[model samples]
Target chain A: MTVVMKMKDIFDCKLLMVDDEPELRKMVNEILRREGFVKIISASNCNEARQIFIHEKPDGVILDVSLPDGDGFSLLSEIRTTSAVPVLFLSARDEDENRLLGLGLGADDYITKPFLPRELTLRLRAVLSRAYFPVILKRTEKPIFRLGKTKIDLNSGAVITKNDQLMLTAKEFALLEKLYENRGNIVTGDSLCRAAWSDNLYGYENTLMVHIRRLREKIEPEPSTPRYLLTVRGLGYKLTGVEDR
Target chain B: MKNLMKILTRYVLSAAGVALILLVVNFAALITWTTQSGKTVRKNYDIAQIADSLLRSDGGYTLPETARNKIETNRQWAMLIDNNSGTVIWSLNQPSEVPQSYTVSDVAGFTRWYLNGYPVTVWKHPDGLFVLGNEKDSVWKYCVTEPMAIMDNAGVWIIIILILNSLVAVLLALLFGLRLFRSLKPLAKGIEDMAEKRPVELSTCGLLGDLAAGINDTSAQLKRQEAALSKRDNARTTWIAGISHDIRTPLSIVMGYSNQLEEDAELPQSKREQAGIIRRQSERIKTLVSDLSLASKLEYDMQPIRRSEIALAALLRQTAVDFLNSGLSDSYDLDVIIKEDAQNAMISGDEELLRRAVSNLIANCIQHNPNGCAIKVTLEKTLGNCSLTVSDNGVGFKQEMLDDLNHPKNSARLENHGLGLTIVRQIIKAHGGITKFYNLAEGGCTVVLSLP
Candidate 1:
């Protein structure tokens, strides 16, 4: 959990929070600050937001559509002439038309008012991650997955759970990666075996089943009746919600 | 006005044509009557002309050469009777067919019956009384004797008149029929337009003008009523919208602060537990407010369903996975079973609404059966309909709630259950579908949403 938060470089980055409501700006700033975002400057109007963009050179911005001075759209256009900094719209206007308009204007994301603070933090982290860093997505080189107490450090080829670390073979890690790649969806057995075993698919079915059983034992609390790693009878297997379950 | 002119032209042409035909026909019949009766019957003019012709040609007391020649040429014979002696004093070309000498009784009988087939009439002259006689065949005998021949000629004339008038009748029928048809054509088009929910646009004229005016009035009334209804619905939507905006902001603050406190590990156990309680209760208020707003939208049919093609099986799987990942207690297990056909079964609907409908059913299962139970979401396609069933091993809905669902008009009964099931029904209805409540024989409730 700590590593995922550290992956996004918010230490040197700055965010400009623009909203007409002082309370919402304060609340969201507090939430982001707690999530390791150190530098967040606030503005209540588009002119102040624009000035902050030029002076402070914020890495990202959270803007409200309705401002005391002007709308968020004009400010977005003004910002566009100078930089390609990521902008997320946080507004009270939640209609489909408004959402489309904001997104079409090249904003990173659009979140309506009265949203979950955690959701905002997660979305902002995602936008920052995608915009600044492109290395975290290199699965073959440095893949890291966290599920409950289990963490699969694919680079080191180890599964750590409850202060105990277990080494994993290259094939087991490969199968697990395939399932994780298509999370919350059924991964067909044929495709799983094909991905883990490059060729000789005719005889790979039994081997794939054995590998699945072994992988479940490592991840499931009760491996006899797995919860997260489940079988779909004749068709495939689904790996779902490892974080919460 | 144009149609009126056409109708007027038809009536005038028909009447004038009929009058001219009858005039010619009646004149021909008159000539036939006069000529046919003149050859035989000695009417008053025939007798008078013959006597005058005889007197003008007479010389001294005997018939002169001109008188004899006139009598022979005109085919007439005359007898002179002396009034003093009451006897026949002179006679010229008097055929054996007539009684030349006559007593007072004989004169009366001959004049009354035209004795011996000689049509005779007596004219009292200066010298003697002249009785003129003509042969019955020389004139039209039946012209007076049988007056029905004149009626027969009139009958022929009437037929001729009617035949001529029939041509005009046909023309008049066509002209008026055309005008009537033109007037009624717009009425048909107006009715079709109204059927399509369009306003009636008809020009009133001719015979159906009154009816067209009535239709226009009805169209205007329909438009006014629709506007009024839309206004009412808009007012309701705006009210609910305002409520959502005003209520959610404060609730967000409450939930945010309490959540932060509950997550603070340095806080005392009692304080943390208290914070948790506040957070959970505030979450409930938030749910209630959101449900009320959605219900208002559904009740008025004001929520526009933004639709798209959705892989329903994938959505079902996604719903179950999301529920498992929602960070709730692992007291309940939710999973999905999708058939191969259902995996690719694409249903058209608003993704957000479908998500809400399915999520509500799963939430209901976890909420009502606090002891926890298994939830299974199954998806399948049959024929053209997609049936999504959210089944749970928990106790099914109470009998009272099930019965209340049947009669939604009873407000008291509707309040028995929470808004979740009502929302499910409304959302599915908006998608042109229906929802059915069933208790599995194996001891659970199955909410079936059949989408078309």
Candidate 2:
């Protein structure tokens, strides 16, 4: 709890809380206020909520799933278009479908309703911590693997080589790293489900397969014959050649 | 038409009932009239002569030869007998065999007689003795029959005619009664069916067609309202999904930039502090927006249930463990009692949705109850359904609030009241199931749910 609060105290941005229930809004406000929040705003409905968002320019917003005039989704859309503020949905709508939908709609985090104030605070800190402290950028000097003149920096995200000419999309990089990270773990078709869809892993194996194939075409030395990555019989694909075996 | 036939039959039966009552009344009147007129018959049949003779000193009285011959040739034999010894003193048909005397009191007791094909009356003389006679066989038999005798027979015929007339009156009353009811039945049926909110089955009976038509109009209006409500519900659901998608785009950018800022390594402590602020506030915004989306989803349509065979007992136990592991179980004491042999109670429903339903029930218990309050969850299997009940010793709802929930027809605006129970209702309904909310007499609320 202290670690989460420590991370949250570093961020000095405006916070907006929207819920129809006054008690809940007050409870959340008290918790965030004690954490050294610089500015805070609250609204009971979407109509008033939109005005608050426009005037306050909050960096983060806490919203109830249900509102009187409209809902948090519409308000999220309006705020997202004109401003860059991460929306974290705190709702009593705890169904998996709801959570999946919220995440799919670019929600940073989904907290079920009747949540503990401290739990929400912790989640808020974790999310805020991710945004404030950048992952350590490992410096890689070894160039063990090369594909399409793209020398793979296995330790760091850097794709560098002797020629120093490489281009790839974020999706492509994520796919490649995912395959290499499970070098010997035999990452099954089901294991990569949540990372992409953030939902149930049923009947989505083909979609993951397509993403993997697309990643290989971009990085493989020869598109038709992959040297570094190998598919195990009747199981799943694995990354080879880490020890040059 | 079958309806017309029904009306006709009812009228006939009613008429028959009335006619039956009249027949009884007429019979009583006929018997009374016959009894009173019987005395008149006795007086005309030589009853006056008998009284005059008894008044004289001697019993024997010599009549004219013509009168004697008439008496002797009489077809109905006459006998005067001694009441004490059964001795005959005078006889018309056989003087040797019949008794000669009869007690005057005994002679006056005759009540009935049959003459020819028609029934005759036997009269007891009010003054003297008995007289039993039919229409006389004489030249002026009609004239010989004293005017009183003629009157007695005529009176009998007239009373019989009166009885018959009363029977006709009853039949007419019954017929009219049937007609009146027939006309009102359709209207009555329409009113009854209207109360039930169903289409009236009665085709308009005459005089009630307008009433039936009115009821049909109201039913049509109700249908229109139902259609409009259905359309609105559909539009609202679609709008929620659309709005959720719209909000996601900018949210991604805000989150992306916040992530980038936090990851910058070369930044000084002051900038990093600023970056931290940016990231935390961005997250708070995301929470608020997602909460709004969830609110809209609840407001619109509940997510459809996808059914599959699942063991409910296992699912409930797993959910309990999940809640406990999530740290809510410790804050609020949880007591779980699954019925013995509850295993193999497989149900067909959306597993995730069912889980959500159970989770909401448990969450409500935890939320409403004070810290350290015991929350009880029980699972039982009944015929053709599995039931799960969640109860807590929390502040229960009032009766009026329960009434409002039971009957939502009041168009109550419970939108902002909270969606935990409302969503529970919607999900249960989608599963073709139901939920019951009851406040225990001691304390708190218990929600019982049943699934097929």
C-alpha lDDT values of all predictions: 0.75, 0.61
Kindly report the interface RMSD of candidate 1, rounded to 1 decimal.
6.3
Runs of candidate 2 with Cα error greater than 4 angstroms are: A1-245, B1-14, B33-215, B228-303, B317-337, B365-377, B382-385, B391-417, B432-447
Q: Give the range of the ten consecutive residues with the poorest summed lDDT in model 2 chain B.
A: B111-120
Most DockQ-accurate candidate: 1
The local lDDT score (0 to 100) that residue B141 gets in candidate 1 is: 33
Fnat of every candidate, listed in order: 0.13, 0.00
Report the C-alpha displacement of residue A82, candidate 2, in angstroms. Answer: 35
- Candidate 2, what DockQ? 0.03
**Per-residue lDDT tens digits of candidate 2, residues A146-179?**
5445577644545565655455556556656666
TM-score of each: 0.63, 0.41
Error of 1 at A172 (Å): 8.0
What is residue A111's positional error in candidate 2, in angstroms?
Answer: 16
What RMSD value applies to candidate 1? 11.8
Tell me the alpha-carbon RMSD of every candidate.
11.8, 16.6
